[model samples]
Target: MAEDRRKEIVRHLSEDDLDRLLAETDDDKISKRLTFVKRLYKGATLEDAADDVGRSSGTATRWARRWNEGGLGLLTPNFGGGRPPKLDEDEQDELIERLRDGQPWKSQEVQHLLSEKFDAEYHPHYLGTFLRDLGLSYAKPRPKRPHQPENPDEILEERVDDALDEDDQPHNKRAGDDGEGWVVDEDVCTDGGTVIGFFDASQPQPYDNSRRVWYVDDPHVERPLVKTEDSAVGFYAPNGESLVTFTEDETKERICEVLELIREQNPGKRILLVLDKHGSHIYEYTRKRAHQLGIDLIFLPSGSPHLNPIEKVWDYLKWTMCPIIVENEGEFKILVKDVFERITRRISYAQSWCEKFLDLQKLS
Candidate 1:
């Protein structure tokens, strides 16, 4: 037969044979043996295979010789057995202590430190495994905060009381109709000074949504002469051809003017006016005058602008006026007039936008 009558005995090696080979040979030597086996399977002579695979003919012949003698067991590796660690228990404890104290040390850092300090050349990965075997793990230290005073309970109690007091206060209450009625909305105008003036009306509704539940059937309807501005003092309403400005004014003239407008608009009907809790709006004179005009001035809760419908109207005006550019005061006024005209004409569209706003608030 042709030697062992097999063209490629390399293919017939079992898993156990391969394991033995790997166990018997180091990684570098096994690599050389694998190359030789490949060449031999490809029909190269033993001598040629040895030379081609960078092994001596004698080593190649020895591998072939072993194969014929005892099958594939000759290729396997054997790990020599050892009793125990050479280092004492105290030494291991010292090593662990040294490692723990010297950290901020990565495995590679520890390995480098070992080589530099103790003339030990350890692979980084092996060092990691060794540390893990010794029950050492990487961990981050907790950060410390500044020391606080011990009597924080008093301060906390005071804060809680203040919060509760604020919560207990009445918020945006709807104004009762006191014979002087007005609509709260924005008005756009072509005034000679600014392109647009925001006319905000402060009239009280029968019920406040901030304080109680109150809904309008036609909340989106554009009541005439309502003008809002993002830049102006407040919303405005038409005072004849000119616009009347509403602000948080304490003066009697402004308060009287507002009262007069409400009485004029609603006639004999009691007027409800919702107003902010500004010092000016809360003056005794303003309140007395409003009472005299049959107007009930309901004060809006502090710091809640969203409760006011006039604020929403102003927002709409700003949205509408964003695209219009005014070169001068005249152009600005014209643009404002045009915007108001468009808004007035497209009443349904304005209504839809307002409805959408309400819907979004609901969803939120």
Candidate 2:
């Protein structure tokens, strides 16, 4: 260890040069080596720099010597490949973008793409690692509904944008803006302004809802089972406000109760409830009540439950209560109440209904 090493405490690669190398590198080993050299340049003893990077003093000393002699080239490890990568960094990134074009590409498909496009051949086995490095993975792709709307996001965004835009203009006779199917109630404000809510219903048993849980050994529970025709009506606002009440059944009259509940929550504002085309939801009784209460019911295209964000809330509730077992209806009611309080309706829930809808809407 030579004591008279550096006159200035910080002098290596000019800070700008070191930073540019650090910024450009994706290899952790090279990053660590550069960091060790950085500490040395900043007047740290070899031992201290080694400790900082979790390397031994001997390792640090070697890195410093290598960098001083050969710069980053010697500091960086060698891949030992006889030839340069067939796909350079930019080309690799471009390939990743193409692979992510909403197709569930199998390894063979990707391999064929590589061969055809880049004139590079990769074995199916080698492709797993290659794809992972490019931030891709093998997993079951989620299925899309056959009847899912091609432009649900554009449709929703336009509806919301137009509703909001109406406030700026004089409220005229609002008609034929969204076509006939768009109008569930003919009486509400056709001009503008609406607070959106996603509405849905689910039937859960009194006994238990189950999902896979972590366990070392197989687990079992001696649980009592009871079946009841109890349904829960839920209104989930994107800003995390939600109202869920147990109902006897999702009948037309019961749907009216939910409309009134939503109106009560929104007060002076108009309510636009997005829900599936359940028979009870679109029934004349529900429509009339919604119009009377200053609410508009937007019927999702038939068989399209995916359009309503509230369904995720119900799925999450069931997932969280999966292990919980309530012996009687009383206990089950208590459980539901306690769990509901904890369900933080993240603003993300609403954003999921809007912001992310466009990107996912076009998926086939």
lDDT of 2: 0.65
lDDT of 1 at 23: 68
RMSD of each: 26.1, 12.9
Q: What's the C-alpha lDDT at position 304 in model 2?
A: 63
lDDT tens per residue, model 1, 82-126: 554433334445566677687656667777766665566656567
lDDT of 2 by residue, 144-248 (tens): 778678876566565444433434332211333332332334434433344667888887554343555566776664456755567878887653246777888
TM-score of 1: 0.29
Residue 24 lDDT in candidate 2:
93
- C-alpha lDDT of candidate 1 relative to the true structure: 0.46
Query: Distance (Å) between predicted and true CA of 331, model 2?
Result: 2.4
Against the reference, the lDDT scores of all candidates come to: 0.46, 0.65
TM-score of each: 0.29, 0.51
